[model samples]
Target chain A: MKFDDLKKLHQKKYRQQFGHFLVEGEHLVLELQRALTRGTLASGSVTLYVSERYANFASPFEKVLLNDRQMSQLSDTKSPQGIVALVPLPEAPTTIQPAGKAIYLWQVQDPGNLGTILRTLAWFGGFRCLLSPGSVDPYNPKVVRASMGAIFHVPLELDVPLAALPDRFARIGCLDLHGESVVADNFVAQDCFVFGNEAQGVPREALSAMGASAFTIAGQGAIESLNLASAVNICAYEIQRAQG
Target chain B: MKFDDLKKLHQKKYRQQFGHFLVEGEHLVLELQRALTRGTLASGSVTLYVSERYANFASPFEKVLLNDRQMSQLSDTKSPQGIVALVPLPEAPTTIQPAGKAIYLWQVQDPGNLGTILRTLAWFGGFRCLLSPGSVDPYNPKVVRASMGAIFHVPLELDVPLAALPDRFARIGCLDLHGESVVADNFVAQDCFVFGNEAQGVPREALSAMGASAFTIAGQGAIESLNLASAVNICAYEIQRAQG
Candidate 1:
C-alpha cells in the first residue's frame, strides 16, 4: 500500500475499504510480533513501518523505512513513537457458539471504554467480545492505543445486533440495580454477559427477556454506577473465581 | 471570581491558588447538589455557571449566567456542555488515621486512571484515598470529569509521602505477580491498599517493606498486567465481599 493509503487507515472508512488497521508504538509492535510467533496471527500479515532511529529493531516481517515526516503522518498520537504496523483486520466468525464465557456490549459509544473492556477480557482469557450496532469502532486509533495490545489478543465480533444474541447464547446475563447479588453462591456461568451503553444501559426489552439473570454487585456506598470497564472487570473476575 | 479567573481553575496551579476546581456537565452539577443535601459537601460552596439555554434548570446554590462564548471559554471539552460549577477544593486532612479501608496510589500519572479509581472507591464507600507524592492532582478538570461526581463523595488526602504511611497504618496491601491469590480464604483486610504507576509496579522498596501483605488476582490468560484502575477495582470489590 502507498503511504497515502496507509494514512487512510486512521479513519474507519479507509480501514473498512482495505481490511487493515494501524497499530502504533513499540509495545504494540512487539505484541503483534509475539502474536505472529504464537500462530494466533498469520505470518507475513504485518507490514512494519519504522523511522531511521528504529530501523535496526529486529523483525521477521516486511519492513518499510520511512523518514521522520512520514512516521509522524502515520502516527495517531502526538510525539510519534517512530514505529507502527499495518496488520490485516481479524475476520469475525460467522456463528458465535453458546458454550463458553463471552461479553456482549450493546451500544457502548466510548472508544476508551470498549478498549479497556477488551484489555480486561484479554487478561482473563477464554472470552470473546461481541459488539452490538452503534458501539465504537474497535479498530479506532484511540481504542487500539488504550487497549495496550489487548486488541491483538482478544477475539472480537462487530456489528452484531441485539436481536441476534438469543439465537446464539442459551444464557444471557446483565447488571441491574434490583437484581440478584453477583456474590451469591447461586451465581451461575452464563454463555454471554451483556453490558449496555455508558448512560442508557441494556435495552429494556433485552433486560426483560433476561429477567432473572440480571445481577448486581452489592456495595455499601452511594455511587450510582461503576465505569463500564470497571463493571466488566469485576464481573469477569467473579466469573473466574466461581470457576475456581 | 471573574470569568477570567474561573478559566484558570482548569489548571492545578490556579486551582490551588484560588482553592477551587471546575466541574462540567449537568450530571456532575446534579451530583454536587445531592452531595450538599446529604451534608457530605457544604451547602454554599458551589457556584453554578450555565448558558442562557440552561438558565431554567433549577439549582440550590448560586448560579451565574454566561453566554455561549463564555461557556465555551470555560469548558475543557471540544463541545461545551453549557453547564459548569466552580466548587471549593476539598481540604485534605493533615493527618490520615487509617482505621478502615483505604486506597493509596503512588506516582499514578494519569488523571483518568485516578478518577476511575476514585469512582470505584466511592461506589464501595467508607474508604479513603491517599495520593503519594507525584500522583496526578485529584482536582484536575479531567480527573473531576472522569470521576462522574465521585470526587464530591470520596474523602481524599494529597501529597502524602510513603514514609508517612507506615506511621498511620498497621497493615498495607499491594498487588504483586507472585503474591498470594486474592481469592484465598486467608486474605485479610489491610488498612490501606497501595497501587503504583501505570507502567511501573509499586516501587521495590515499598513492596519489600510490605512483602507478606502483597496479593495477586489470578487469571487464565497471558496478559502481562491489568490496567492500574481495573486492578484497584477488583481488589476493592474483593475487600468489600470479604467484609460482608
Candidate 2:
C-alpha cells in the first residue's frame, strides 16, 4: 500500500474502501501481533508502521519505517506513540452465530461509550458485540483507542439490524424501569441483550414487537439515566456473575 | 459577580476562589432549579444566565440575560445550550460523614470519567462521593456537562485524603484481582468503597495499611482492566442488588 493510503485510513470511508483500519500505539500493535499469533487474525494481513525509536520492535509482520514527521501525520492522538498497525478488518462469519450471548447496541453514538462497552464485553468473555445499523463504526479511531486494545479481542458484527433481532434470538432482553430486577433468576436466561441510544432508549413499540423481556438495575431514581457505557457494563457484569 | 468572574469559573482555581462553579446547558440549569426548590441547594446561592431564548424559562433563582456571543464565551461545549448557572459549591459537613456509604475515588483525573462516575453514584443513591486531593475538580466545566445534571443530585466531599480513610470508614472495600467475589454476601456490608486512579490502582501499601477488604468483579481476563467508571458502576449495581 502507498504511504498516502496509510494517512487515509484515519477516515471512515477510506478505511471501508481499503478494508483495513489503523491501530495506533504500542498496546494495540502488540495486541494485533498477539492476535495474529493466536490465529485469531490471519498472519499476513497486518503491516506495522514505526518510527526509528520503535523500528527494532521484534515482530513477524512486515515493517514499514516512517520518519517521526510521517509517523505523527499518520497518528491521531496528540502524543504519537511512534508505532501503528494497519490490520485487515475481521470478516464476519455469515454462516454461523458466534458461540456466545449476543450484546446488541442500537444506535449508540458516543465513540468512547462504544469503545468502553467493547472493553467491558471482552473482559466478561462469552459475548459478541452486535452493533445496530445506525451505530458508530467500531473501527473508528476513537473507538479503537478507547477500547484500549480490546477491539482486537472482542468479536464485533457491524450493521446488525435491530428489527432482525427477533428472528435471530428467541429470548431478547433490555433494561427498563418497570422490569424484572437484574438480580432475578430469569434475567440471566436471555440469549441476547439489547441496549438503546444514549438519549433515546429502546422504544415502546419496538420492545412490544420483539417480545423482548425487560430487566431493571435497581437505583434510587435520583438521576434519570446512567451513562450508556455504565449501563452496559453493569448488565455485562450481572450476566457474568449470574452465570458464574 | 462580574461577567469576567463568571468566565473564569471554567478554571479550577477561579471556581475555588469565587466559591462557585459553572453548570451549563438547559438540563443542568433545570436540575439546578429542581435542586434549589427541593432545598438540597441553599436558596440565594445561585444565579442563572441565559440567552434570549431561555430568558423566559421558569426559575426561582436570579436570572441574567447574556447576548449570544457572551453565552458562547461562557460555554465550554462546541454547541452552547444557551443556559448556564453559577452555583455555589456544596459545602461539606465537617462534623459528620453524610448519611450513606462513601465512594472514595483516589486521584481520578479524567473529567468525563469523574462525571460519569458521579452519575453512577447518584443513580445508585445512598452513596457519597469522596474525591482524594489530587482528583479532578468536580466543578470543572467538562465534568459538569458530562454529568448530565447528576452533579447536582450526588453529594460530594472534595479533597478527602486517602490516609484519612481508615479513621473515617469502619470497613473499607476495594476491587482487586485476587479477592473475594463481589457477589459474596459480605461485600454488601461495607461502610465505604475505595476506587483507584485510571492507570495506577490503590497502592499495595495503602491497601494493606487501610486494611481494605478486596472484592473482585469476575471477568475472563482477556483485557487487563475495566474502565474505572465501569468498574465503579458494576460495584455500585452489585451493592444495590445485594442490599435490595
Candidate 3:
C-alpha cells in the first residue's frame, strides 16, 4: 500500500471509523506476530505493515512489508523506529469483572499521569481501573502514548461515578499522605485501591463512603505527595504481595 | 503589574532575562510559601501575584496579593488556579556529590518521563540524578509541570559524560531486563544506577564498564519494559530494602 494511505490512520476519526490504529517499533511488531501465531489476537487480525528499508534491517519477525513515508506518518514518535502496523482495536471490555485487585482514580487530572498509572497497573499484572467523573479523558493522545500500548491490554472503565464504586467492588482503599500508613494493616480482600487528584486526596464524601481512612506512603517530604504512578506501583505491589 | 506584563514571562527570552518563571495552582503556592518561610529558596524569591477573586478565597499561605488581571498575566495555565508565583530558580549544587545512591539517565527523550523520574527519586529520598548528554532538558516546561515542583528538591548534574561517571561513584549498575533478577540481588550501590534511552538499554560499551550485566522488574507479558520512572522507583525501593 502507498505511504500516504498508512499516514491516514494517525487521526482518531480515521481510527474510529475504520477500527484500526497504528503500532510502531520492532518489539511491538514481534509481539503482534507472536500473538497472531499463538491465536492470542482477536478474530479480526491486523495487516502486518512494515517499510521495505526496515524489513532489510535485520528483524526476526517475518511478514515485513509497507511504505516508508506511510510508516512514518502512522507512527506517533518523532524518530520513527522504522516499522508500523495497522492493528485492529481489541474490543473494549464493558463488564466490570470482580478482578482480584482494582485501582480507582478520583478526578485525576493529567493525561500523562493517568497514562503512566494505567501502564503501571498493566505492568504489575493484577489490577483493573475505574475512572471517576472528573478525570482526564483516558483516550487523550498523550495518555495513549505514555501508556505504551497498555491502554489496550488493561481493563478500563470511564465516566464511572465515585458513588457507584462501592456496590461494584469488595473493599475500597484510598491513598492519602496524611492518613494511616499503608504498611500497618493486611489488605485481606480483593481490593480496590483509590488514588485521588494529585493536589487533593479523595474527597471527604468519597472517604466517608469508603469507611477506611487514607493510607500514605511513608517517605521524606521533599514534596507534598507521591507521583500518581509511583503511588499506584507501591500500593499495587503491596496489595499483590498481601494477596499471596 | 498588568496581566499582559506577567503573561509575557512565559516566553523564554523574558524568563531568562528576569531569571524568573511562573508556577500556578494552590499546591505549588502553598509549597513555595513553606519554602519561603523556611528560607529554603536561594536562587531568588516568590512574588505571590494573585488576583482579587482568589483573595476572596482563603489562602493556606501568606501571599503577596495581586488583582485578577495582574495574576492572569503572570500565569501560564489556561484556567489559572487564581494563584501564580514568580519563583526563584533552585540553586544548582556544585560538585556532584558521590551520594551512594544515584540514577544516571542517558539520552532520556521525554520531558514528562524525566519529570516523573525526578518526582520518584524525591519520594524515595536517597537517590540523586545525573544526566548524561542528550537527556531531556530538566528545565523544559513540560518537565516542570510533570515534576510537581520536584525540580526544586531533586539534586541533579547535567551533560556529564558516561566515561567519567564510573570513577565518580562506587558501584555502577545498568538496568537490562535480560541480565539478572533485580529482586535476586541486594542492589546496595553507594554509586550510580544508569537507565538508558527509552527504546534502548544502556549502550554496550557503557554496559561492560558499569561492572554488571542487567536487571529487570519481574512481570508478565503485557509490558516489554517498565517505564523509566517506574523502573527507577521499583529498583530504588528494592535497593533500600536490601541494604536495610
- Stretches of candidate 2 exceeding 4 Å from the true structure: none
For model 1, residues B1-244, the per-residue Cα lDDT tens digits are 9889999888889999999989999999988888888787854878889999899999887888999999999999999999999898776655547346778888989989988998988888878888988889988888988899998988888888877777777777777776789887556557777777898877778667755377888775556788999999999889888888
Alpha carbon deviation, residue B237, candidate 1 (Å): 0.8
Task: Order candidates by lDDT, high to low.
Answer: 2, 1, 3
lDDT of 2 by residue, A1-244 (tens): 8889889998889988999999998888877776776666745768899999988999887889999899899999899999999889888866566688889999999999999999999889888999998899999999998999888888888998888898888899987766888888898899999888898888879888889999887787777888899989998888888888
Q: Write the per-residue lDDT of candidate 2 for residues B188-224, one digit (tens) a residue.
A: 8998998888998889798898899998877887878
The residue-by-residue lDDT of candidate 3 on B19-92, one tens digit each, is: 66677777666665665555556633456666766665454444667766655556666666677767655556
Which CAPRI quality tier does the interface of model 3 achieve?
acceptable
Cα displacement (angstroms), candidate 1, residue A97, comes to 2.1
Which digits, one per residue and each the tens of the lDDT, describe model 3 over residues A36-71? 654545654555556676666543344446566655
In model 3, residue pairs whose N, Cα or C atoms come closer than 3 Å (at least 3 residues apart or on different chains), thus clashing, are A50-A66, B3-B73, B6-B73, B7-B73, B51-B67, B51-B68, B100-B190
Over the stretch A104-167, how does candidate 1's per-residue lDDT look in tens digits? 8888888888888888888888778889888899999899888888888888889988877777
Error of 2 at B29 (Å): 0.8
Q: lDDT, candidate 1, residue B175?
A: 78
Question: If scored against the real structure, what TM-score would every candidate get?
Answer: 0.95, 0.97, 0.73
Alpha carbon lDDT of residue B128, candidate 2?
Answer: 79
Give the range where candidate 1 chain B is weakest over 10 consecutive residues by summed lDDT: B91-100
